[model samples]
Target chain A: MNSAAGFTSQDSATRISVGDALTPEDVSASSAVAAEDTARYALMLGDDCLILAQRLGNWISRAPELEEDIALGNIALDLLGHARFFLTYAGSAWGKSEDDLAYFRDEEDFRSCRLVEQDNGDFGKTIARQLIFSFYTHELYSRLVDSADATLAAIADKALKEVDYHQDHAAQWLLRLGGGTAESSRRVQAGLDAAWPYVEELFADVEPTERLAEQGVAVLPSALREPVLDRLHAIITEAGLNPPEAKGAFGADRSGRFSEHRGFILAEMQVLARQHPGASW
Target chain B: MEETDRNAPTDQVPEGGVVTEDPAEHSVWPLWEVFVRSSRGLSHVHAGSLHAPDAAMALRNARDLYTRRNEGTSLWVVPAADITASDPDSKGGYFESPKGKSYRHATYYKQSEGVPHL
Candidate 1:
């Protein structure tokens, strides 16, 4: 069923109109200055999902098993859908389309957390990253469903259901890889350790996010940290794996300071879109 | 030469006993037949098949593949090997009787023409 407003059943069947929930008028009605902050907040969320979706797409033919291949592909498609909605709504404020926001942005302009920009080293490493990110997204979206902004609330309401499945997918893989064999357990443990340093940056409270949270238009990242970490630690312990104690990467997301790997990811993703301007199939 | 010699021993069969390959060794995940209920009033119909490691994964895979377009409210997955079917050779004997039972059809009863709920 289509959850977003203004989407007819016919439109939902044939295609997804990502911007169905919000109109240009709705965005323009809000104060232009406030709209800018909301737009920036939306960009942070949109960039996170967009980058992770690209990472997940890389596993289409490369997952360890065929079932996992399809599973990851489905999750990637869902994340891409979420990214499109957020980007479209965010773009409305600046008179830009979803494609403009996604394709034209440089690596420094992206607001994705360091965790999502990290390399998907192996199945184990990818699962470790998915586990942390999905749990955090689950909490974030759950709270955002009640945002004062109707458009943001609608987008979050739809995205929250999909994130539930993503969390389950990552949790299942984490359990299996952690409990499977001696070598498997060792690799996944190492994967968790490698990804642990990036976790804290996801909950870092930046100025825009803080301002938006106060206005009831965005979820406070700091508020999600305790519950998300508590749930993640329990799962890690249950899987017979130890949670890593590492310092977080220091920097505000979307402030031109990004993880080292973000540049390479952006270069590959934007190459085609940048080469062919205003082109569509 | 030593590395090649070390691998060669594994390829050799032991004396007297035949070397049997494990059937599960080279097999992928088992295939599952998927059925989906489009809505509350509809019966579950066979949708398609997919490969998964277990029942839980099979169900999840079916949901992703079949219901991505909002096609179904419920899903069922059965291991392909568990289903038993009638032999094609016995199709005439098994299904012939129903063909000749014209009285079972509503159209065969002339008196039912005037009945509203018939």
Candidate 2:
């Protein structure tokens, strides 16, 4: 557990090693509470990570190879950890626990964007989703480190490093799959085509986030679009694949309106908690 | 080193496209040996092995396999086939020559009486 690099800590003794990120328990005990708008903003971020983690978790035993299986599982766990941090902070504002927010929320209450809820069609498609999601977070968290709220800033700074590794992982796979054999290239290209339309929904300015962005507590999602798109195009070209020209999907909002896959993902995620209330492992 | 007939077969590598049990697909990544440095000052010890397409991907696989628990400060991956080892069947010739040669050892000689730092 390496202590978070560049996170401001007034007490040097508390600092540990790399990857020793902030746990939700730390957020629970801390004095910093999320403001109303900041809570709503954090909820969306948390939900996105939560749903994607669920999607990634399905690959634990199903990835193409053993090495790849472990890689995807580790990534799923990291996303879950990020979700815990954000959800715990968000829960602070509403007198709820992280589990309460995660397990009890209905499909309509979830504020996650459509991109995360989209299906992991194949290994290539999953990698495509990972590329888009990780690159987007890399940009969002990079800017979010400077948020006016100290806790959000700290969480973002910590999550940024892990997300950067995720971006590298996805980009490496993209290069390999896009440039390998003819079949590999075709599958990965089709993957990009399947996932590209959902990209625009990620950049939409939704609810409390748009307001929080004005106060410097949350990043403006639209501001991240150009950089994420440009990098995606450059990487896609470098891998010898054409940039996807798919039109943006309709009804791209954080209101949980656009996606049909959200319910299935939620059912799987919330089942154990819902089945046996107050369950602890 | 063990000097048995079982330790002498290095020529019996399975040919490409002959992997039978994997069932799903035939493309098998090459095996890579992983070494991990536990901390800044420590030497990298043999961690484990994994299969990957290339050296760059091998490093990433090594990280996920050996260093996921923060057990390493640094990592190195080498293709398993690249590492040549002494033939275990010739261990008697390679290792037994040094046996009963006490005169070649410094402990076989007495230090100078009362010499400083002897």
Q: Compared with the true structure, what per-residue lDDT tens digits does model 1 show for residues A1-281?
A: 24333445454554523333333344434443228889889888999999999999999999887768888999998898888878888887888877898999887788888888888888999999999999999999999999998888878888888899999988887887898899889888989999998898888888698988988999999899999999999999999999998888667454647577888888888899999998776
Residue range A1-281, candidate 2, lDDT tens digits? 21333344333553323344576777888888898889999999999999999999999889999999999999999999899999999999999999999999999999998888888889988988999999999999999999999999988988998998999999999999998989888988998898898899889988867788889889998999999999999999999998999999898886766678998999888999999989875
The residue-level lDDT of candidate 2 at A275 comes to: 99
lDDT string, candidate 2, B60-99, tens digits: 9898998876678899999988999899899998999999
Q: Which stretches of candidate 2 lie over 4 Å from their true place?
A: A1-19, B1-26, B100-109
Q: What fraction of the real A-B contacts shows up in model 2?
A: 0.73
Q: Give a tens-digit lDDT track for model 1, residues B1-118.
A: 4445643445467644566666357777788999998778989999999887779878988988888777778999999889998998999999987997999998887875667875
Clashing pairs in 1: none
